[model samples]
Target: MKVKVAKTAGFCFGVQRAVDKVYELIDSSEDPIYTLGPIIHNEEVVKDLENRGVHVTDEDSLEKLPPGSTVVIRSHGVGKAVYDKLDGLKLSYVDVTCPFVLKIHRIVERESAKGAHIVIIGDREHPEVVGIRGWCRGDCTVIKTSAEAEQFNPPAEKQVCVVSQTTFNYNKFKDLVEILGKKRYDNNVLNIFNVLNTICNATEERQKEAKSIAGEVDTMLVVGGRHSSNTQKLFEICKKECENTYYIQTPVDLDSEMFQCSSYVGITAGASTPKKIIEEVQEHVRIKF
Candidate 1:
């Protein structure tokens, strides 16, 4: 079997920034370190950090930390109220939020304060979405799909701005915007629709590459954390193109049987995935061949 790998399949800018910050802080400080949440979505990475004494304790475990302990905010970012809580505790910390996510929060805050209803196109429960919503003074709606967009009844009839989580699926964002536009015309709603392409360029480029590879290959191997939204989306995209797609977090998840009848294999990964994981998976498939 011939094995192909995407050059873009690994950590993107934001994940790299977040992961690097954790190491920088750990190396520089003697004080006990804590992350507000898992530094990144990958379990292997988080476990490695934990082994290094860089730990993520629950919010209720806050008091157990030393008084002067420094906290690192994860890349996905957190709400404004969470910052206030951190301040109330007089915690010293680093804000390692991805610049891309910060940009979305700014957009959400600015547009919502102007009395325009805000529509966030992404998973409602995602930490990034919840963080963006916290910035808005007026109410905002979160919808994951065109179906949600169709059924959604806004609190206000007119004046709205639309934004997306940085890692959200780009095509879905565009499709939802088009659906919202149609809804506006159907209701004769005087809309102030502003659609921002908040999806990161890295995500768009990697996904595009994955789709291209999936189309020509007999089977695809998607490597990344199971909880990674972008990784799961990659699996969905590849599965549609190549039905013999396998979603694996690491080489351990791979089966020799999946490769038995395959002539060509493609490999892709989520933005938060480390390059070593991808390389190992690629090497595994080659050995089987």
Candidate 2:
């Protein structure tokens, strides 16, 4: 069997930076350290970090922290108020928000403050989108598909500024933009239709590479946690390109049914996944198939 692996799979710049911050703090900080969330969505990585002393907490859970503990902000940057709470409590901590995500926060805040209605093109429930919404101090809406963009009921045509969550699907973003563009119906035009390409370059690169690889292989293996949004998106992308694609969290999740007749395999992973997990999947396939 010939196996082709995506060159850009695993540990994107933001995820790598966030994961590194947790490990570094776990080793250096003597006080109990907690992350605003799982740091990233990969449970395997979170479990590993837990074993090394890092803990996970959320916005609501922070109040339960024993006094004087450090709280690490996850890569999905928190709003100003959340950080201010840590300051009020005099908590020692680290902010490991990816520079790319930070830029989106700034963009939404600036645009919203200037009176442009903010629009985020991604899952509303996703932590990254939630964080982006926090930065906008005013009206903001999130829609994941072109149909939702069609139904979006913002105040007026030109009053909206479209921005995307960093990890949103690239092609989908372009489609949403087209949908919004068609809605600028006005002699009554709301006067300002702003579009900010806030999707992270790393995410775009990974998806492009994964799709190209999936298109060429007989079977595709997407590696990362089930809860990882990017990983789930990767699986969907690969499955669309190659119907034989399978999603697995680790080597343990691999199913032989996916490889029964496939000879050419392609592999890719989510930003939150580690390189070792990708390697393990490749090795597992090599040995079994």
Candidate 3:
């Protein structure tokens, strides 16, 4: 059996930078360190950081922190309220929010200030989306599916600014945008609507790469945290291309039985996955199957 791993499979630029900064702080910083959330969606990385004395915290828990504690904002990025709260607490912080995500925040903040309704195309409850929502100075909407898009009924004259969560599925983002365009409101609304493709380049490349590899393989393995949005999107894309797709977080989750009928296996990982985990999965497939 030939097992092919995606070249784009592993930590994207933002995730790599955030994780690296945390480890650097662990080695150099004397103050107690905490992340506003898990630095990334990967459980293993978060657990490792916790074991090394880097505690995971939430915005509500900021007040409970001991004095002189330093907080690291995770790549998911928080809303403006979080920064304000941090300042109110007078706690020092290191912001490692992904640049792509930060760009969306700025766009939402700017557009909403100008009286445009902000429309975010992604999961409403996702930290990233929640953060993006916090940036809007005016009305904001989060639409995750075609049904949501169909039901979206903003005032006919509302000037809209549409942006996507950086890790959202590229094709789905397009579909949602298309649905929004077809909504039964004023025809002029499309003219005033500004749709920005905010899905990061890394995410687009990874999803496209997974689709291509999955089409050519007899079986596909998608590796990442179960709760990882990008990883889940990859799994969804791969499953559509190849029915024999499996989502696994680690080598232990792999079952040899799933590969019995496969001659060519394609492996791809989400943006937050670590290289070490991908390498171990690759090694396991090569040795066990």
Top-lDDT candidate index:
3
Candidate 3, residues 1-289, lDDT tens digits: the string is 7999999999999999999999999999899999998899999999988899999888889999999999999899989999999999999999999999999999999999989989999999999999999899988989998899888886667688899999899999999888877663545444467899999999999999999999999999999998899999999999999999999999999897889888999999999999999999999999999
The lDDT values for all models are 0.86, 0.86, 0.92
lDDT of 2 at 60: 82
Off by over 4 Å in 2: 186-191
Residue-level lDDT tens digits of model 1 in 164-249: 88878777888888888776655565555777888888889988999999999988999999789889888888888888999999
TM-score of 3: 0.97
Q: Which structure among the candidates has the greatest TM-score?
A: 3
Clashes of each: 0, 1, 0
Q: How does model 1 fare in lDDT?
A: 0.86
Candidate 1: how large is its RMSD? 1.4
Better of 1 and 3 by lDDT: 3
> Which residue pairs collide in model 2, if any?
158-190
- Give RMSD to native, each candidate: 1.4, 1.5, 1.3
lDDT value for model 3: 0.92
